[model samples]
Target: MRRPATTRAITRATTLAAAALVAAGSLSACAVGGSDDGPLVVVSTNILGDVVENLVGDEVEVMTLMKPDADPHSFEISAQEAARLRSADLVVSNGLGLEEGLQQHLDAAADEDVPTFVAGDVIEVLEYAEGDAAGTPDSHFWTDPARVLDVVDALAPVLADLDGVDAGVVEEQAADYRAEVEQVDAEMTESFASIPAERRALVTNHHVFGYLADRFDFEVVGAVIPGGTTLAAPSASDLADLVGAVEETGVPTIFAESSSPDRLVQALASEADVHVDVVELFTESLTAPDGGAPDYLTMMRVNTERITDGLSA
Candidate 1:
């Protein structure tokens, strides 16, 4: 027997619809300091949210739109939250078309003169070289810790200048945090250097590791999905070709994206008839507080360790 939906469900639907309408409405309705909830910084992804929180400390409130273990490409915010974007003290996003659904909202905030920092803008961006997505900018720049340093360089000053926040604390934290990033970068270099370059080939759920490959001398042998984004579907021939690549490359593992399902990669491994292992990595999103990857540094270190371990096997 079917159970009828409750009033709470109907109220939730109405709230989302209202938010959409507000998001689509005039920016003129946006108020000064948009959130009375307190000194606020709104970030599009949990990863960047963690970065910003580290810089700001407890001086301000950080509103992260995307939850842990969620895909950033297709995630959307409430219209009310979209409206709040225009009013926040600062907005940070990993811009290169990574936030597919939320780009318009980011743009709206920028259009309203909200000082928005895009991670892609500060870092040297990589473009897709082949396929239909050829020439499209890859937004997965955080894969390289060095490029993320560029992001920190560009944002540190802007964050220091925000009103109601202690500039000294921001600078101090940024420097300390940058040092931590540098240390991690050195460790990753030393560790991955141990792996034979030929053995350092990779296959992922999607085209996500271009920067990481470029930085660490790893080869992006192939992907289960064809494009830079996860929403892409693979044709049978695509899977067949990837299977052949796997066989030829002798790559040992196919990394299942943490934010996405591994069923496809699992099936791909079976279909390819290869004895490859499928491993999960926190690729795009962070995890809950108690999960394996709770922040950017931990996420990168965990991935580095896993990648090294997998390929070295």
Candidate 2:
């Protein structure tokens, strides 16, 4: 006997639905793709996640919403990770408008009464120039090791309050980390001082190194993209202007952020019609444990050496 049309249609619909359910389940199974166990600390970016991991030191679970080397400005969390943020014992974020896509989720987590800590809240913030960023605040605080020391200082006390955490351990780890940060700072300061005054100029893919510039006394000639975030693209005239700045400022290298595309910075260097080198630096994100910049201290040290070499060349 032949099946009725209605029965056949229903069978097809059911099969489609089951397939959809399986696919959805698979996606949800690895939602946000991070570790989860013990008291949870959900951080917005991998950089901060590394810091939190070091500070907490297995006392509690640490889950970073952003993937390794992901751009903090535009990286977003999954719905499941957003839910985790809401339920996490503490949600730590860079704040200062850095996580543009994740800001709403951070706010949602805070609204749900989850304990939240904004690293920008404790550290001093820098602003863009009058015509550079339309008056946006600079959000790349981790560029400055001194400021990262400030982050460690702020998080140590807050993390100590989490249940099952030992305050003594937190303080000790924080103190050790601060010393490391200071050591890197001193090393970078001395390394950067070796560059001649005329060679201390910088031109990057974007306005990423403001904190580094301010801390180390390097002049930010300009960026290929005239803003703090990489989401903004450059107009022909913007590239033209940066090319002129590169030539006029005598920038030896146009530093491209490791996390951002180098096409535009390359274009600027190519347009400069000079022998300007385009050097890659781990500016915003941390690499995997096996990568050169696996942690904050290593990242800073690597970038310091790269910048020092690139500029002094």
Candidate 3:
């Protein structure tokens, strides 16, 4: 069964719905901040923010720069946040060109010698299989739980090195989270095993599923957008080409990422000759506390179930 929207999600939707009229007045009030005390760990994206929080618990203050439902490709940070990044005890970011807008700030933080951890560094990276970004390293490694476990394993030692954190506590917490991640991995493997080989094809808003496809032995049929980033738009010919691919593959469902608008995917489904269904997946970011995908593990499970159901039907 599909989950209902959380209270925080409803509140965020309402805020955005009214932003055009009230943004100017609400600018100062909406600024994000965390406690000035304790060891501060600044994270570029909310997805990583959740992971860091789970691993460290209340031992450190995690300041997640990206808001829930925000696109990491184009989400910009405030000057205050950038300053925080430079001064943070440790800064965590999803690297390999994922944070396009925040790259300069990340560079600035590193320039100032903030200990930084890039999640992409520890995993076996996959390249974009096709499109304009073909052959470029794909930074969406978290799609594969095995790769995510690599990140978890590498991160535990780093968190243990943090000055205020108890090394034993960090290791224990990471072990617990590691077990949870492994359980999700086993569940995903079992669930995806049920999908027929012919039906294991993915089409998304962009080329975000390359790692998932590589991990699960699925074919990346194509994408509505031509590249790895959602900031890029599709041309008419691009859409036409994708329509042909969809018709050829006869994939029942095409996915739209939650962090991006589904209009283009919906339009592509409408344009397809086959009866295509557009399903939303939490590809880039996590949702609020009451959301279906509030954390990394839940996000993967929700997506695994959705993909299984979407393709099985």
TM-score of each: 0.86, 0.86, 0.87
lDDT of 3 by residue, 113-209 (tens): 9999999999899888677888999988889889988988999899888887788888889999999999999999999999988899988999888
List the candidates ranked by TM-score, beginning with the highest. 3, 1, 2
Top candidate on TM-score is 3
lDDT of 1 by residue, 1-313 (tens): 6445787788889999999888766453454345453467899999999988888887778899999988999888998898888898899999898999888899989999988888888889999755557799988998999998898888988888878778899999999999999999998999899888788998988889999999888888888888888888888888888899898988888899899899889988887655899999998999998989999999999999999998988
How many angstroms is residue 121 displaced in model 2 relative to the true structure, after the best TM-score fit? Answer: 0.7
What TM-score should be assigned to candidate 3? 0.87
Residue pairs in clash, model 1: 19-79
Backbone clash total for model 2 is 0
Q: Across residues 1-313, which tens digit of lDDT does each residue of candidate 2 receive?
A: 9999999999999999999999998887665343343579999899999899888886778899988888888887778888888999999999888898888888888888999999999999999873458578899888888899888888899999888788898888888777877898899999999988899988888888889889999898988888888888778888787888888888788888889999888877877867999889998888888867888888888888988899888
List ranges where model 1 is wrong by over 4 Å: 1-38
The lDDT values for all models are 0.88, 0.86, 0.89
Task: Give the lDDT of residue 174 in candidate 2.
Answer: 82
Candidate 2 matches the true fold with a TM-score of: 0.86
Candidate 2 ranges with C-alpha deviation above 4 Å: 1-37, 130-132
Output the lDDT of residue 95, model 3.
98
